[model samples]
Target: MSGRKLRQLKEAMATILDDLNRGDLFSIVVFSEKVEVWDPALGEAEMQDNLGRLRDWTESTTDAERSGTPAPSVITAITLENTNKAKRFVQNLTTYSATNIHGALMKALQILEVGRSASPEQTNHAEERPEPMIIFLTDGQANVGVSDTFRIVSSVTAANAGNSSIFSLALGNGADFPFLKKLSLRNSGFARKIYEASDTALQLTDFYRQVASPLLANVTFRYQPDQVEPQSVTRLAFRRFFSGSELVVAGRLHGNNVTGEVQAHSSSGSARYPFDPVILPTTPTANTMERLWAYLTIQQLLEDDDASTSPGKQRALELALTYSFVTPLTSLVVVRPDNETRPVEPEEASFAAADRSRAPSHVSPVSLSSFPVQGAAKTSHNAYSRILPGGYQDMRPISSSGAYYADLILPAYPVSTSASLDDILWLSPNDTTVSLPTGVNGTSEVLNLATADETNAAYAACVTPGGQPGHCRHLKYCVLLTFLNNQTEFLPFFCRIDSFVGVCCQDDS
Candidate 1:
């Protein structure tokens, strides 16, 4: 972390300590290559006293670090007292060698479990269970012990044992968004990304406040048959729900049914909050609810696919293609006119006449036509654009050749006028590659691009400073390309397509 980021984290931690209620139980676990828990054996009263001491210590250390002194080791622990220990721990945290995410998470889980078992009296009371949860924060990929994402997630899940929820905060652009998101989703919590900025402290505080307010826990949504029975129902269970958040569930009707009853099951499982379902008049309007349901279902299936189930993977692909989503199983193929090729001028084509001196001798030029072509299929962009409000008409128009162009919007930088098609690549769910179309044409013969790994390797070799692969490992499937007026001016730039409903943007270089 940068000095600015460290300061922001300290500020956020102070705010969190201030916001905590007196009866609330909390713990802090910090890890680099090893884990450290501050005040591990301190009781409630002793912990509070330790917190005061920690506050003074942290202030002194902060002053030293700000004066150009090297940062000290991490200080972390858990507590139930209203003390500044958590704040001081955050302030004293320093960037270390490798990120031991698995160790940190495992240690947290152990603490929660120990707390639960050690206090059976408190565990018996629903309100006194302490709402065991792990708020995991990380800024980089796991490079220490048990670095494999799936293994780490599985270990966390097993450690949770359905008693605790894991709320993950991915700090900065380097954090693995997908890994954190999936981890939280599977464990009955949610993941959020915290971008590095001046207001990062404020963002962290707000997120803490939101997660701190849990209106309901272990919630389940069920549909009861009143007039008719539905053909199927999607799984509707969440580990925790915030005070102001909304929960939506969607399903299909078996017949021409109009009325049904939906019930919500919460902590008091027997008590059901029932409501008469309302069916809005179906017109030519976009089916936002249905699409949302599909997206959620696909997300669940993808998470389940981590278990190596082939059926779940197949179902996710089916939904993605049905909705025109670019998933691991499908690629977005852009078709343009085959006659749009530019001719090489005789003078410009001559090796001697060309500006060879400006080009690197060690690097070889790659042609867009080098990619293979596949067949074309007709599809709409509605599935991809439904996340945005308004309606289908608000979407950008499809080109006459049936090509869909999505504008890449970035808040920090100006949008590119045109992006090289060579820059467009497909990223699979597992961060593996399926295929990348080098270029596309309106003709029946579509370009069949190289596999994701091959394309990434080639692109990495040419773009990376060290000519090493995996340098662009963070590159996702969602790519924003520059829109050029003439296709012949550069290689065809394709949009980063995904199985989910969201906009794509350029990678943070």
Candidate 2:
């Protein structure tokens, strides 16, 4: 993972830490080769010492981390002091070893179990309290302990006695979205892929806000038997309900009307939102209700991945197509219904292949471009635009082949001192340079530098919209171009490349 992403992760943690109040009880579990519960109260020096012990334990060099001396496990009650400590802890974290996803989750669940058993509110069923939540963050697949995806899923399910919600944040392209989604779906949560970009921290913090406030816990909706089709109901049971969001319970009623009740445990006490019997037709927008049910059904079915749900997936696809909705099962397609496809316009590039008028320079007699026989009608080479990976390149129609693209030729002439430059670099079609030897006292030789370098942190960056590695290069050399004003839409940096103001971009579009 990039250091940029790691910094954003730290920022997100800081945001969450700052947002929490005294009511929140939190513990962090990060695992790679071994599992460890992070103590928010520990100072940086102490934490690093403990971390060293944990590392040695992983390597079998020491038993200090695993032995009878139970490592400090401080399930922190949110306070300004604890929050600052936690932020420091998060800031110092570094990615290491192979991911131990199973171990990490099990460790988190164990922490939650400890917290639950120790809490007075948990013991009192009537007392409303914050439901246990596990915000699992990882960048890549589990490659260490209990790596088998299915095995890990089953083991986690078995270990999670509290049925604590696991919101999985997949931080980059290396993550397995399907696996995370499956795990979360099985454990009363969901998965979100945080794309690596400029606003990565915002994405993380925004997601945290959605799950931060627990308005109700153990939420469920119930209706009288025969009033609504039981199988048709859309996720009646929920782990928790958050503030500023509707907990929709959708189902197809057997008749026109039905009575139901929403049962939940809120912050105050046991709560029941009971509904009285009413005619379904009292709702004027009948189609709206049907659409809502269809929407919910599509969402639920698409999320389910059980092999038996193949038919359900198909039904979801049908509903998505019928309703013109984009879902996992369906993609949004743009069709040119009128066959009104825009034709690519043609363009041309002309070069004086050989400097016909050279100032005191003797050169080769041959030229890449031939001059029209004096007085003969000038034959024009119309360069039809060829769609390229980087962009359009000039192409001219040849009799033999359908069309032929030309090699990029820049302004150059065979000089007296050397027939060729010390560097004869063949530039790309998008390139606008040619290497040559130095001239008079004031002149200088040409230089061709690489697009990116790890040594120069300022020059190294991801310039592509999709977050692929790229670096700043001259507009003429950089095939893919984006507006300088629209820097926020793409990568992090731009720089100078020789005489040109460089834009960060890869060689390809």
Candidate 3:
């Protein structure tokens, strides 16, 4: 996470600490290259006086000067008064090099295990067993020890042993969302992506509140075999259902009818709930259920093993193709008209390839030139018109293998037909202004064109309608103009073309 994002995370953590209830048992485990837990001294506190001392210690450790210092510890239980200590711990968190995801999970599982093993006198057992959960937050890929997704999942499974659930929060664009989603799904938890924008803290806090509430645990579902057989169900049972959470089961119908009753077991074998028998349409035109089933099956396949060569992956690709659903394995191809003869440049080719690999299959690429130019109606007064010579043109044809459509246009400058070399005024560096020289006739008057500041301002005005600055367009045009003005041979090539016409279009057409 960036420094600003880290601060937002701290604020979110503080909110969580503030909302913690009296009976709630919590632990703060912050990790980067290493894992750090609150001081053991804070955990040993039995009286209200010790709580004050714990808070003081936390505040001292979180001092700005001490932010760079690293501490080595594991986990500390949070009490009523120690909430401040937890908040302090979160506030002091600083960015560290390398992400040790495996280490973090292992440490969290170990802490939960210790909590479960605590004596009855130390932890009340008659009320209920505290649901052990780890809220894993990360903004980058794992680069430290045991970085493999499968290896990390295996380690988490062994350490967790069905005792703890991992709720993952992927922060920013750099986060590996798919990997985190798989990790959470395997552990019977939830996963969410936190975009890089304002109100991230609110989003984090809202997500925390949802995961904090557990309506049910250790849920299992059973369907009638004669009516419908469970071809594929959500791997992680609905172990932790929140207030607004929905439980959906997708399976294939055995006969022509889709009628079955579902039996649900919850609370670690203590309670049972039976759902009403479902009656689906027999001759429905739209196969909504089948499509839903395919989606769930694909998710399970991806969660199980995402290796391209794996059988599960192959099956997922086949299912996606059969259902006409876009998947990571497939790329959408667009056919252009025969008259469009624009060639794909090297930069555009690279851009298309990268975009295709990352973007979701359903979303098509949009042409950059297709976007309307701001203040285009008044091109004469518009500063951007002077900077971008060609203005807007159709994008080059995209490669079929590329993911999204390639829509970037190479920079082109306008060639002047009426204006001669002498008509262009040189900008004086001392005064930072442009002035046209007097005509051959003595009666002709000099005219000022623009100031250096205005020319510089034109660079920012050259932007796409979507509000993206056209830095490449401005830079390339500037370079071409400078070359034409300085080199005598290039002057002949540019002289014959009209000032309003693009050199690239003239040569290509």
Candidate 1 residue spans exceeding 4 A from truth: 40-81, 117-129, 225-232, 255-270, 284-286, 307-309, 326-388, 391-509
Q: Alpha-carbon error at 233 in model 1, in Å?
A: 3.0
Per-residue lDDT for 1-509 in model 1, tens only? 55777788888888787876533455666566655555433444654554322211221234343233111212222234324545544665666556778767766665665565433332333343356677887778887777899998887887677468787888777779889988887787777767565446755765676567665676665544642234334556766655534443445544433332334434445345544433334434555555544555675687666655588888887676555444445443332355333322222122111111111111111111101011111112111111222212223324332222233232232233243334433222333232221211010112222333433221211111111111122133323333122221112122121211111122333
Error of 1 at 490 (Å): 33
Each candidate's lDDT (Cα)? Answer: 0.46, 0.54, 0.48
TM-score of every model versus the real structure: 0.56, 0.60, 0.57
lDDT of model 2 at position 189: 86
- Ten-residue stretch with the least lDDT total in model 1: 369-378
RMSD of 3: 20.4
Ranking by TM-score: 2, 3, 1
Candidate 3: misplaced stretches above 4 Å? 43-79, 118-126, 143-150, 173-178, 230-236, 255-269, 278-280, 335-509
The residue-level lDDT of candidate 1 at 318 comes to 69
Model 2 residue runs over 4 Å out of place are 40-44, 48-72, 119-128, 277-286, 308-311, 314-334, 337-509
lDDT over C-alpha atoms for residue 268 of model 1: 45
Clashes of each: 16, 0, 4
**Which pairs clash in the backbone of model 2?**
none
lDDT of each residue in 1-509, candidate 3, tens digit only: 65768888888888888776544566666556655555534443432333213211121234463233222223334465467666655655556667878766766676676666555443433355566788999888888777898888776876678556788888877778788987887787757777554446755775676567665676555545664544544442556655433344455545544322333434354676544442423434434345545655675687678566999998887776655554566543333465443433332121111111111223221111001112111001111111111211222324343233333333344432333334323323343222111111001112332322223222111222122223211111233342344322122121101111111112111
Backbone clash tally (model 2):
0
* Root-mean-square deviation of every model: 17.7, 21.6, 20.4
